[model samples]
Target: MTAADFQIDDREGGSVLRLTGDWTTTGLGSGARDLQARLGEGRVTALDVSELGRFDTAGALTLVQATTEALPKDAWASRPEAGRIYAMVETLERQSAPPPRRPDALTRTFAKIGRGVFDIGHEMLLSMAFLGRLTTATGGALRRPGSIRWPAWFSQGERAGLDAMPIVAVTNFFIGAVIAFLGANLLTQFGAGVFTVQLVAVATLRELAVLITAILLAGRSASSFAAEIGSMRMNQEVDAMQVMGVNPFQALVIPRLAAMIIMLPLLTFIGMLAGFLGGMLVTWSQLSYGPSFFIQRISEDPMMGTHLMVGMVKAPVFAVVIAAIGCRQGMSVAGDVESLGRRVTAAVVQAIFAIILLDAVFALIFLELNL
Candidate 1:
C-alpha cells in the first residue's frame, strides 16, 4: 500500500488540500497527524480526495477533523466513496457532541429526586418478586421435607440466635434500666414512684425488648447473611448450584429464614427476661422497691400478658423481613468485591428500616384492636 500524504497549495480564493496515496489506517501512519498540523496553518477552501487511494473511515475522520469549516457538497464529487465516508463521520461527530447547555439547579435537583423515587419503586418490585420465589421454594421444601437441609438450619440458628444473645441481652438490659430510672425520677414528682414498676414491665414487654432484639439482628445476622451469600454469588457458587439443579432458595435462603424464625422469638424472650431483671434492679436501687415488689406489681397488671403477647408475635415477622432482605440483597450482588460490600451494607440498612416500618404498623394494628 502507498503511504498516505497530503499537500497544501495556495489557490486563487484560499488554500486547497490535496490528499493522495492509500488513506487507509495501515497506510496513514504519521501522515494523518501531519495533515492536521499542516491544515491548521491555513484555512483549506477545497478538498481534493480524487487521489485518495484505498480510502476508509479512518482517513475520512482525519480529513473531517483537519478542516474547521464544513466541506462543500462537490468537494469529494469525483470520489463519491470518500464523500459517503466523510458524511458518515460527520454525522457521528454531531451525534456524539455534548449537550448545548447544562441543566439548571432546580432541574437537576428534581431529576435526582425523580431518580431516587424510581429506584425505590424498582427495588420494592424486585423484593416482592424475590419473596414470591422464596415462598414457592419453601412450599416445595415443605412438600419434600427430606430435601430440607437440617444441618444448615441448625448451624444458622446457633450463629444468629445463640451467639447473638449476649449483645441483645446487654442492650435491652441497659435500655430497661434507663427507662426504670427515668420513670422513678419522674413519677416521684407526682408521688407515684411505685408506678415505675408497671411502666418498666409494660414498656419492656410491649416494645423495647423485641424492637431492640430485631434491630440487633438487623445489624448482625442480616449483614452476615448478605456477606455470606454475596461472597457465594461473587464466586459463582450460586450459578454452580443452579447448574447442578439445586434451588438456591431452598439451600441457602430457606435455612437462614427458618433459623431466624426459630431463633428471633427465643432471643426476644431472653431479651425480655434480661430487661425485666435490669428494670427490677434499677427500681430497687432508685425507689427502695425490692425485686419481689417489682414482680408483684407487673404480675398484677391485667395488660402485662397482652403486652408480652403483642411483642412476641412481632418477632417472627421481623425475623422474616430481616432474613429476606439480606438474602435478596445478596442474590442481587454482582461478581465483584465492591458489589458484595454494597449489598451487605444495603442489607443491614434496609432490614433496619423495614423493621422500624413494620413495628409502626404492628403498633397501629394493636392500638386499633385495643390489645
Candidate 2:
C-alpha cells in the first residue's frame, strides 16, 4: 500500500483530480480524508483512478464519497475494474435517499403547535370513548348486582383512598396553616387580621382541600392504576381475561373508577376538616384567636355553605377524569417496559391537566351563578 495522491490539474473550466495509491485503511486514510475535504468544494470536475493500487470497502467508500461530493459531473474511474466497486457503492447510496433537512424554526414552531392541538383533540375523543365503555360496564353491573365485584371495590378503595389518608391529612394541615399565615400577614395591613380565620376556613373548605387532594391522588393513585393496569397489559393478562369471556372494564377499570368516585369526596371532606384544624392551630398561635371564636366566625359566614358545596361538587368529576385517564393510558400500553413507563407518565400528566381544567370550569360556572 502506498500514500494517496490527490493531484489537481487546473484547466479553463474547473480542474482534473488524479486519485492514486491504495486509498484502503492500511494506506493513507488520513490523506484520502484530506483529499476528500479538498475535492468536496466542487473544484474537481473530473476524476482519474487508473493508478489506484490496493482496493477494499474502505477504499471504495472513500472514492464513493469523493465522487458523490463532485456533483453536476460524473467522476468515473479511468480503469474499468475499479468502476464496478464504485458502481456498487453508488447503487447502495442511491437506494437509500438522504433524509430531508429539518424545517426552519418558525415552520417547526407552527407544526409543533398544530400537532399539539391535534393530540389534544385525539386524546379527548379517546377519553370520551373510554368513558362510554365504562358507563356501559357500570350499567351492566347495575342490572345484575351479584356480578359486581364487591371485594375488588373494597380493595381498590382501601388502596387508593384509605391508605392515602395520612399524607392527605398532614399535607392539607400544613397547607391550611400556610394560608392562614399569609392571610394574617396581608389582612393585618388593613386592620382586618381577624378575618384571617375566615379566609382559611373559606379557602380550605371551598377550594384548597379538594384541589390539593385531587392533585395528590393524580400523582399517587392515578400513577398506581396506570402502572398496575399497564403491567397487566404488558403481561397479556388483560388479554387473557378477555379470552376467558371476562370483561376487563368490569373487573379492572370499574372498581378503580368507583373507588376514586367514592373516595375523592370522602377524602375531600377529611381534607377540609384537617385544613380547618390546621388553620385553627395557626390562628390561635399567631393571632391568639381561640377555637370557639373560629367556630363562631365560620358559622356566621353566609358564603361558607355555598363555597363548601361548590368544591365538593367537583370531586366526582375530578375522580372520573383521573381514574378514566389512568385506566385509558393503561389499556393503551404496548407490550414493553418503556411503553408502560411512558403511558404511566402520560396518564399522570393528562389527569392533572384534566383536574385543573375542570376546576377552572367549575370556578367559571360558580362565578356566573354568583355563588
For every candidate, C-alpha RMSD to the true structure in Å: 7.0, 3.9
lDDT of 1 by residue, 1-371 (tens): 89998888988778988888988888887866787777675677887877779888888788777877667769888988778888889778756868689889999999999999999999999998998999999999999999999999999999999999999999999999999999999999999999999888889898999999999999999999999999999899999999999999999999999999999999999999999999999999989999888888888888888999999999999999999999999999998899999999999999999999999999899989999
Reference-based lDDT, residue 166, model 2 = 95
lDDT of 1 at 43: 74
Q: List candidate 2 stretches off by more than 4 Å.
A: 1-22, 25-28, 37-54, 68-84, 94-107
For model 1, where is the 10-residue window of minimal lDDT?
A: 35-44
Residue pairs with clashing backbones, model 2: none
Instruction: Tell me how far the alpha carbon of residue 241 in candidate 2 is from the true structure, in angstroms, after superposition.
Output: 0.7
